[model samples]
Target: MSPVVIPARIKKILIIKPSAFGDIIHSLPFLNAVKSTFPNARIDWVVAHGLHTFLEGHPMIDKLWVIKKDQWKKIGYLKSTLNEIFGLVKGLGKEKYDIAFDLSGILRSGLITLASKAYMKIGFEESDEGSPFFYTHKIKGGMDNHAIDRYLKLAGFIGCDTSSVNYPFAPFDNHSDICNILPPNYVVISPSAGKPANQWPAEKYGELASMLPLPSVVISSGADAAIAERVVKFSQGKALSIAGKTTLKGLMPIIKGARFFITNDTGPMHLAAALEVPVVAVFGPANPVRTGPYGSIHRVIQKKLPCSPCYAWQPCSHWRCMNELTVREVFDVVKEMTET
Candidate 1:
């Protein structure tokens, strides 16, 4: 595909990447690349409602178009959903964007790209749900590459420097309340994942936390409170449960100040990596090479089963990949990490 030329007049730009915290973090380097190349351009992002808090005051982005994707998906919200959709299209059409990038690569994001009425629309050639059809320009974003690298390929297509991966997140004031409760020099553990198959057992996490040298602070959202509680319970008071207490913005400081982090394949795992905290990530059905913690300092623990890296959404009958990983194995990695 031919490279996209940003005209001299190009000013306002729209980036459509709506949900999932980890994917949003992966897209930050791309945002950095775009902003670095076109410093004067007004960069806007369409982010999902709950996740928009992270980007609310972002320095690189001029506007954040929050979409209530979860609320719209509810069966009872038919009328409201239609109104919201039409309103979004109408509002976006008025922006007169010079360029729009569909980084999410889903049907909804494709529609959002089309609705932007931008002079140039760009997206991945292999985007799912025929989303590539909406793009005026398409770049080859490899499936095998890390999500961060795949996103950088899009920036490269737009003549942005992708050589250096940087996350240009705006500075955040530390949530002193969170800090006050957390023990000094503690390890943060996020033992829950979006998919059940990707999660290592909560009891196993408890076992690992109990053996750690430092006090373990178990973090969890409202949805994952049960999992966090189980980890705390099984730890026999070794780990403290801080579930449903902090916001996404508040989580940065907690992770940034962490001695190290331990988690399953989850969003907070990515958060820890972005914060430059050393991570000990446990992998199961998901492929660690593609989506695991990024950076040289982090460690990934996974069993090398013949059917490993299965990338399955549903639970397998045996689930030998996660079942086979022992708490001792994870503790050993943590011990090694802390020593250095």
Candidate 2:
């Protein structure tokens, strides 16, 4: 489809991408590109509640339309969820945006694009759940491309210069209060994955930590504390668990200061990659080509199997893709990275 012509002066803009840490990290370059393109325009974002904290106080964005999306899933909260959605639609319509980009390309995001009532509604033709029908303009965001590249394609489509790919995180300090409890020098291990299928065994992570040159620190949400604790318990005193101790913003300094990072295909792995921290990312059923660490300074470890990259959020009875990958196999890469 042919693109809509952007107005000569775009006074206000809306960007729709919410939730999940890795995907949000992928969108940072697009945010940077658009900010450079429209320095004078007011740019607002529709971000989910918890993830909003990560983008909170972002320098490039003017206003954040925080939504209670996580709460929307609870049947008990249906009334409140509907009320919040109503407020969101009415408040967004009031913005009178010149352009709105639906980066997420989903049913919920499509509704957000429609609610904005922007002069130019842009999204990917490949967006899921019939979301493309809602957009006035559609770009071909190929699924094969890295998410960073895919998001930048939208920036290029919107007349923003995409020559420089950069992750402009909001200003954060180098010191974390939780750092006080951490070892002076440690390798950070993110042993838990959002999907069980994407995870390597937590016990194997502990075994790997035992072999590392420095002590290891485990990070996770309170929900995944069991996995984090399992890693610590099996580390033979080579690792410490700080799960549920730090906020999202607090995580930056910890990742930034780590000697190196070891993780499954999860959000903090991307954060580590963005911070230029060397990462040894263990992949299971997910396609690393599309969602792996973005830079050259990363090593991805996955068992070579035809059934791999299945993206099975729910693990089958025997998941050899991750189950077959031994701690020694992962340690070889970690050792090589540390040596070099």
Listed in order, each prediction's TM-score against the native is 0.97, 0.97
Q: Which ten residues in a row have the lowest lDDT in candidate 2?
A: 1-10
Kindly provide the TM-score of model 2 when superposed on the true structure, using C-alpha atoms: 0.97
Candidate 1 lowest-lDDT run of ten: 1-10
Question: Model 2: clashing residue pairs?
Answer: none
**What lDDT does candidate 2 reach at residue 193?**
88
Question: Could you give candidate 2's per-residue lDDT for residues 1-340 as a string of tens digits?
Answer: 3333555488998999986889989999999998898888999999988999999889999999999888988999999999999999999999999889999999999989999999889899999999998998899989999899988988888788888789999777689788888889989999998898898889999888888889999999999999999998889989999899988889999999898999999999999999999999999999988999999999999889988778899888899998889999999998898889
Give lDDT per model, in order.
Answer: 0.90, 0.90
lDDT of 1 at 192: 87
lDDT by residue (1-340, candidate 1, tens digit) is 5556776557999999997999999999999998889999999999999999989888899999998999777989888989999999999999999899998998889999999999889998999998999999888988899999998998888788989978877667776586898888799999888888999999999988888878899998988999999999888788988888988888889899999999989999998998899999999999988899989999999998999888887779999989889999999988887788
- The Cα error of candidate 2 at residue 42, in Å, is 0.6
Q: After superposition, how far is residue 219 of candidate 2 from its true place, in Å?
A: 0.5
* Root-mean-square deviation per candidate: 1.2, 1.3
